[model samples]
Target: MEDIGYGLLDRAMIHQITERWRHGGIGIIVLQLRHVNAASLEAVQLWESQQTRLFWRYRMENDYFFFLNRMKSDRQMKLILDSAITSLKKGLQAAAAESSVDERAKPPFTIGTASASPSGLGRSAETMIYHALRDATLSMLRLRMKEDETELPFGSGQAGARSEWSSSVGIGILAKAIPTFDLHAQVSSLAKLFESNTHVQGAVIVNQGRPVGLVMKEKMHQMLAGQFGLPLYWNRSVEKIMDDDSLVVDASIPVEQVAQLAMARDISRLYDVVTITRNGKLLGAASIRSILECITNLRTEEARTANPLTGLPGNAAIQREMKQRIESRQPFAVIYADLDYFKWYNDCFGFAQGDALIRYTAAVLQDVTGILGGRGDFIGHIGGDDFIILTGSSAEDADKLCRNMIWRFDGGIKSFYNGEDVAHVVDRSGNRIEQNGVSVSLSLVYCDGSEDITTEHISQAAARLKKQAKQLNGSVHVMGEVFEKHLGEGRV
Candidate 1:
C-alpha cells in the first residue's frame, strides 16, 4: 500500500502488464470507479485492506482498479461482487449512522461492476479494458434504473453487432502524454528533453494535479528562435511560452465523434493535437496525424460497404439499421423496393439507361425518406434496382411514401423514352413487356418492436412482401399484414 507503484503506472508499463496478463489468459475482476479523488482513493484502499487474501492489483488513469479473478464460472464472479455490494451498503449505512463523522465529507465510490478475460492474443489488453469499462457503465445505469438482473451486462463477453466499435479502446493516443510541473524549471532542461526523445511533441504542465497549460514543440521552438529569447527566458517558467488554448477531450468519446469534434475547431486550432482525459485527468494526446489517419480508415470502411452504382449503403448498413430499430423498440417500418421488369428494360435500353433508372430510384428513395420519414429515416441500396428504407412505422406515412415514389418515377419515366414512344404510349418493345414504363414496387413490413426480432426476420418478411407487390398490375405498395390475410401464412 505504501509503494509508489500504486496509481503510478505510465501507459507503457500499463500496456506491458496488460500484455502479460492477456497472454497468460488471466481473467480480471475490476472495480470501476465513477470518479478518482482523495475520498475515492481512501474508499478503494479501505475496501482493498479488508480483503486479506488478494490477487495482483492494477489501476488505470486512477479510475479503474483491476485484480485477477480466478473464478471458474460467472455464478462465482456474481457471488464475489454480490458480497462486496452488501458490504458496501452496510458501510454506507454505518457512515450515515455515525453522527460524530463530518456531515459534508462523503466517501468517493465505485459504481456497478463488470469483468473480462481476454482470450485470443488478437485482442489487445486496452480493448478488453474498454469493453469491461463499458460494461460497468451500463451496469451502473441499470442499477440506477432499479432493474433486476438475471445475468451480467454486455452478456458477459458476448459480442453483438455494435459491440465491436462500442468495446474498442481509444486510438493509439493514451500512451503519448508525459507530465511536466515546476514551471520555473530551466528551458535548457526542456530543450534537452526535446532533444532526447524525438517522439515527444508536447508535454502537459500540471501543478498540484491540475492541468494549467500545454507546452508544444512548435510554440517552444518559435519562442527560442527569436533574438535573445532563449537567454532571456532560459530560466523562466514554461507557462509563459505554453499554449493556454489547448485542445482537450474526454477519453470515452468514440473515434467517429472525436473526428467530428476535433475537426470543428477554429482554423487556427484545427491542427492542434487533442488532449484525452478520463474523469478530468490527463490521459494523453492524439496527434493531428493520428486523427486524420483514423478518419481515413473510417471513410474507407464506409466506402467498402457502399453500393458501386447508387453509392448508397449496402446490406451491412441496412441490416445494422434494422437491428438498431429493433433494439430501440421504436415503431418503424422496413421498406423493400424493387424495380419491376427492370431486367427486360435493361436488355432493351442497354446498360446506360438501366444505370440511369437505378440512380433515379436511389434519389427518389432518399427524397421520400427525407421528406416524409422521421428524423432517423434512411435509404440504402442492396445492389441492382433493389433498395431498403427505414422510417416511422405509421401506416399513413408508409402509404404516402409508396405513392410519392411511384408518382415521381412515373412522372420522370417519359423523358427516358424516345419521342415516338411518348407519342405511342407503348412502343413495340413496351407492348411485349408485361409491366408498364419501368414501374417501381415497394413492399412494407411493420414491426411494433414488442417481440424479439432479428435482422434475418426483417429481411425475410420484406422479401415476401416485395414478391406480392410485384404480382400486381402496376407499381404499388403491399403491406405484409394485409398480404398475410390474403394469401395466408404459407405465401405471406
Candidate 2:
C-alpha cells in the first residue's frame, strides 16, 4: 500500500506503470482478485464487506493526501502526464520498427509526438491518470484484435436479421476502393505505392483477407522523413506502423451515422480514413473529408426540397417518394389533406395566422401518423394548407388515420379562433355568416397492386377525391375506388 502511494508521486514510476499497463500486466489485477465462490456465499459476503470498508477508509485518508501532497505542481504534473502518453505512443511505434536498424537509430515513425499528446490543461492529476489508463486499455484492445486476426476465422458480424437502418443510404456511396496491402507487406513497397499514386491517401491493411488496420500516406511520409528515415522501417512489415485504431464500419451503415462516428474520434485520428466492410469482408475505404462533404450535400439538397412553412418534404420529394413506391409495386395509400374554407380564413385572420394554422395542421398529421403509422410511412407538405401522407398501411388503417386527423384538427382549430368566430360571425352591417371555422378534408386513394399506377395516377385520383370531400359538410374524408371496389369511406 505504501509502495503504491509512493509510485503515484514519482514521475519515473508513473511512466513505468503506463508502460506495464499498455503491455497488459497490471490491467487485470482487480479481475484476478475478483474470484468469488458462489458455493460459499457467506465467505464471499465477508470478503466483499472487508474490501468495501478498506476502500472507503483508504479513499478518505491516504487517497486524499496522496493527491494533495504532489511531488510536482499541477502544470508540471500535466506536462509529465502528457509526456508519458506521448512516450507510450512513440515507444510502441519505435519498438515495432526498430528491428531494421541498430539501437542507436531512432524509430522513423516517431515524428508525430505532438499529435499524440493529450490536452491535459485544467485537469487534476487523478483525471490525467484516468486518461492515461484509458489510452493504455484501448491500445491493449487493438493489440488483442491484431493477435486474434491470425487465430480467428473471418465471419460476418453476429448472426441475425439485418437492421432496417442498414437499408438506408449506404456508406459505400462515399467509399473508394483504394489500394489494399497485406499486413506483412514491406514498408518500402507501400512507400512506392503511395509514390506512384499521388491521389491515394491511405491503404487498408488486411490479415488473411480480414481488414485489420490503415496506413495513411501523410503519416507514413512523416514517419520515413525522420533522421534514420527509410533505413529504420524500409524492410519492416506495414503492420508495425499501421493504425489499428482506425474506424471500421459495415458498408450498409447509414452515412449520417458514419459521419457522427467519424467526428467523434480522437483529435489525432479525426482525419483518418474510415474502413468500410461488407459482411465482415473488406469492401472499401472513405476519407473523413469525403464523409463530411457527403453529409453537407445531403442536408443542402433536403433543405432545398423541404417545405419552408411546415418543414415537411415538398412536391419534389413527394413525387420521388410516390414514384419509388410505384416502381417497387408495393400496395400504398396516398391521403391528400386540404384545408376547407382556408381562403376565407386567410382573408379574415391574415397570413401569419394562416401560416400558424398550416403549421398546426402539420403537427396534428405528424401526431396521428406517429400513433398509427408503420415503418416507411411518409408525411409531406404540398403547399400552404395542403399536406400529403404516403403510407404502406392497409386501407383500414388509412381510414382510421384520416378519421383521427379530422377529430384532432377539429378539436385544435377551435383554439385558433374567437368564440364568436368558431360557429357564426356577424359582419358590421348586421349580416350573419355561417362560419364553420377551418377544417381538413382528407382524400384517400388506395392501390391494391392489380392495375398499373404512376405518381400522376395517384395525384389525379386524390385530386378528384379531394373535390368530392370539399363538396360535402365540415371535415369529411372520401375514398376513391380501385378495381371497382371501395377500400374505405368515412365522414366526420
Pick the TM-score winner.
2
Which ranges in model 2 have alpha carbons more than 4 Å from their true place? 1-173, 182-188, 191-199, 204-254, 257-284, 327-332, 370-377, 392-400, 424-435, 446-452, 479-485
- Evaluated against the true structure, the overall lDDT of model 1 is 0.59
- Candidate 2, residues 1-107: lDDT per residue as tens digits? 23233222234445644443333222211101011123222332333343211111111110111111112222343353344435434443444443433423222
Cα displacement (Å) at residue 248, model 2? 7.2
Model 1 lDDT, residue 25, Cα: 29
Clash number by candidate, in order: 0, 0
| Superposed Cα RMSD, model 1 | 19.3
Best candidate according to lDDT: 2
| Per-residue alpha-carbon lDDT of candidate 1 for residues 1-492, written as tens digits (9 for 90 to 100) | 322223212343355446544543233334433334455455556766664323446563433444434334334555666666666555544543443444343233335676656566687666665555446644553342222111223221111111122112354344365757555666667877887888776777765555667776655766686788788877777767776777677775656566566655543344457777777776777876466445434434544566667666677767766676777776778778888777766776889988988887887777766677765576777888888887864866776777787778787776766542622223235555444467777887777767777787777777787767756656777776422432321111
The candidate 1 region of ten consecutive residues with least summed lDDT is 154-163
